[model samples]
Target chain A: MADAEAKERRILVAVDEGEESMYALSWCLKNLICESSKDTLILLYVKPPRVVYTALDGTGYMFSSDIITTMEKYSNDVAGCVIEKAKTLCRDLQNVKVETKVEHGDPRDVICEMTGKLGADMLVMGSHGYGLIKRAFLGSVSNHCAQNASCPVLIVKRPKSTAGSN
Target chain B: MADAEAKERRILVAVDEGEESMYALSWCLKNLICESSKDTLILLYVKPPRVVYTALDGTGYMFSSDIITTMEKYSNDVAGCVIEKAKTLCRDLQNVKVETKVEHGDPRDVICEMTGKLGADMLVMGSHGYGLIKRAFLGSVSNHCAQNASCPVLIVKRPKSTAGSN
Candidate 1:
C-alpha cells in the first residue's frame, strides 16, 4: 500500500538550447508538479544528424579525423550544456528523479518515439508560438509531437513580455 | 491585491461530438482545476460550414427550407448535447463558472481566434491519438491550436483502456 501510494509518474520534457524550452522547464516546475506528487522528469535533447555535403555523383570525401573529432566534441558539449541547464532548473524540487538523454534524429520523430518508449504519462514542451503563416509553411516540433505522441502533451508558452528574459 | 488574487482563469475547452473530447473534459476536471482556483470554462463547439453544391458555371443550388431547417436543428442539437455533457462533468465542482458558445467555421481557425479574443490563460483539448500515418495526412485540430494559440495549450489524452469508455 505504501508503494502504491508512491505512484511515480514519468514526465518527458523535450529541451533544447532555446529559451522557450528552458522557460517550459521552469513553468513545469512551477505549475505542474506539487509536493505530494512522485514524479520523474526525463530531459531529452535531440541533435540533428550530421549533414554531409556530397558531390554530384553522390560520392563525398570522408571527413578528416580532425574535423570528425571537433564535431564529436561539439555534439558532446551541446548535450552536456542543455542537460545541465535542465538539471539546474529542477535543483529545487526535492525527491523528484531526473534523467537526461541525448538522441540524434529529427526532433518530431524522436520526441514521439521516446515518449512511448519511456512510458511517459505526459510530454511537455515549449511552443515558439510562430504566427499562423509561418507555422503553416515551416511546421513546428511541438505541433508534430502533439499530433503523434501516444500520451497527453502539454505545450507551455511564456507570456510575450517575459518571453525572452529566460 | 484581493482582486488580483481573484483573477479568474478563463480556460477555453474545445468540444465535439466525440467520446475522445468528452474524455478530455473529464481528465481536465480531474487533473487541472481545483476549488481554490478561480476558473471559468468556455465550452466551444465549431460547426463545420454547411456545404453547398455548385454547378459547373459556379451557380450554386440553394437548399429548400425544410433541408436548411433540418441542418440547423441537427447543428443545434449537437452543440447543446456537447455543452450539456461538459457541464454535467463539472457538476461536482462547486463555484466554477461554465459558459457555452457555438460558432460556424473550421475548428482550427475558430479555436485559435477565440482563444486570443477570450484572453484565455490556457486552452485544453483532447487529441484523437491518430497514428503517425493518419495524423500526417489528416491534420489534427489540437495540433493546430498548440502551434497557433497565444496561450499555453494542454492536450488531455485518455488512457487507452479508459479512452472510449467515457
Candidate 2:
C-alpha cells in the first residue's frame, strides 16, 4: 500500500451561490483528486460586504425596522446553502479530508490570502463565462486569483454543450 | 501491458517566448501528465501580427526593409526557441504524442479557437502574474483563456520565492 500521508496535496476551491462554482467543485472532485492522492479539499466562500442604503438625503425616507434583519438572514442563508452543496459533493470521497470556510471580504483578496496562509498546492475556481465587456465592468474574481494566488490556479469552465446539464 | 492507445488524452498547452510559459510546461509535465495516461501534448505559439508604421500626414515614412526583416527574424527566433524548449522537456516521456503549432492572430482568440477545434481535454498555460493596474492596462492571455476556452484551463504561476530561479 502507498503511504497515504506521504503525498498529501492541499487543494483550495472557491465556491459561491452560482451553478458554475458548483460545477467546478464537481469537476475538481472527479478529475483532480484521485482516490489514492490523500488530498485535502478546502472550500472557501467569500461573502460580499453588505451595504444598506436609506433615502435620508433630504427625502426624509427611512427603511423598515425589519429590513436589516431580513438582509442579514438572507445572506446567512445563502452562505449556508452553498456550504451544504459543497459538503454533499464531497461526502463520498474516501480518505480525503474536507473543510469549509466563510469569510467576509473581496473574493479575490480573501481567496489569494487564504491560499497563501493555508500553503495550498493548488487553487481551483470556476469561470462564469462572461464576455470581455462584462468582465471589465465587473472585475473578474477568477482572473485576479489566477494572477495573485501564491499557488497554481485551475479555472474550470463548463463546456458549451454541457451548459444545460447544470 | 496497458493499452496506451485506448487511454490517450489530448492536452493543449499555450506557450510564448516567456520563462513563465516554459515553467508552466515543466509543471504540467511533472504534475499532470504521466506515462500511463498516454497524453498528446499540443504546444501552441501565437505570433502577433506585424505592425507597419506610417507618418501622421499620410507620408510614406515606412520602416526600412532591413529593419522590418530584422524584427521579423527576431520574432521567428523567439517562437522557435519556445517550441524547441517545450519539445526538449517532453523528450523523455514514453508513449506520449507531441505536436507543435504556430498561428498568427491575437493570443487569446487563437488559443480558445484551437482548443475547441482540436477537442482538447485540457488547456494549460502560464500567468505573467501582472498586478491589478497592469492587468487593466494590458489584457492577460491566461485570464481570457480561463473564461473562454472550451476545456478546463490551468494557469500555472511560479511561486514568489522561485521568481529568481529562471
Best by TM-score: 2
TM-score on B-chain, cand. 2? 0.83
Q: Write the per-residue lDDT of candidate 2 for residues B1-166, one digit (tens) a residue.
A: 1222245679899888777788888888766665555578999987765532122214556777886788688878878987898899888877678999988766778889999899888889989722333334447878788988888899998777777976
Q: Score the docking of each candidate (DockQ).
A: 0.31, 0.36
The list of candidate 2 runs beyond 4 A from truth reads A1-6, A52-66, A129-138, B1-8, B52-60, B63-70, B129-138
Q: Estimate the lDDT of model 1.
A: 0.73
Q: Report the lDDT of model 2 for residue A123.
A: 88
What fraction of native interface contacts does model 2 preserve? 0.50
lDDT by residue for model 2 (A68-122), tens: 6776788789889999999999898877889899997657678899999988988
Q: Tens-digit lDDT track for model 1 on A74-165?
A: 87797789899899998877767888899986677888999999999788898852233323443687777776888878898766889666
Interface RMSD of 1: 6.6
**In lDDT terms, which candidate is top?**
2
Q: Candidate 2, after superposition: displacement of residue A42 in Å?
A: 1.5
Share of true Cα-Cα contacts across chains kept by each model = 0.41, 0.50
